[model samples]
Target: MYDWTQDKAVRVLTRLASEGLQTDQIVDDIISHVDDFRYEAQMPTFYFLSGLTGNKKVASKVASLLQR
Candidate 1:
């Protein structure tokens, strides 16, 4: 079974990095887990990235995805 504690850690770290609310450690975490995150974490990553950098494209993509 998936270990949600670890999974949640990955998500949290990725979000922190995306928000620029972190240092290199969170980025390292994101990079280290990138492969495993392809399925579940992609949307959260996009959400956090959009929130931090105000990327309209990412936001629009998420919006479109939700719209469907």
Candidate 2:
């Protein structure tokens, strides 16, 4: 069984980013959830944050989080 909740979050975040919505806060929220105990939750958050590496607004924050 899979946790759809995490998938839903990732999908929503991706959609929001694709639409040029409030991406900074979206990235920040994703970064904050990177340490989630659930692999389902953590991996998607990490992947999403990783995909934002080229985004200037949140790149440093994502890089800092990735370095930890």
Please report, in order, the local distance difference test score of every candidate based on alpha carbons: 0.55, 0.66
| lDDT string, candidate 1, 1-68, tens digits | 54445556655765766666763565545544554655556555654545445544445555775686
How high is each candidate's TM-score? 0.39, 0.59
Best TM-score goes to which candidate?
2
Give the Å shift of residue 67 in candidate 2: 6.1
In model 2, residue pairs whose N, Cα or C atoms come closer than 3 Å (at least 3 residues apart or on different chains), thus clashing, are none
Highest lDDT scorer: 2
TM-score: model 1 vs. ground truth: 0.39
Backbone clashes per model, in order? 0, 0
Lowest lDDT block of 10, candidate 1: 49-58
Root-mean-square deviation of Cα positions for candidate 2 versus the true structure, in angstroms: 3.1
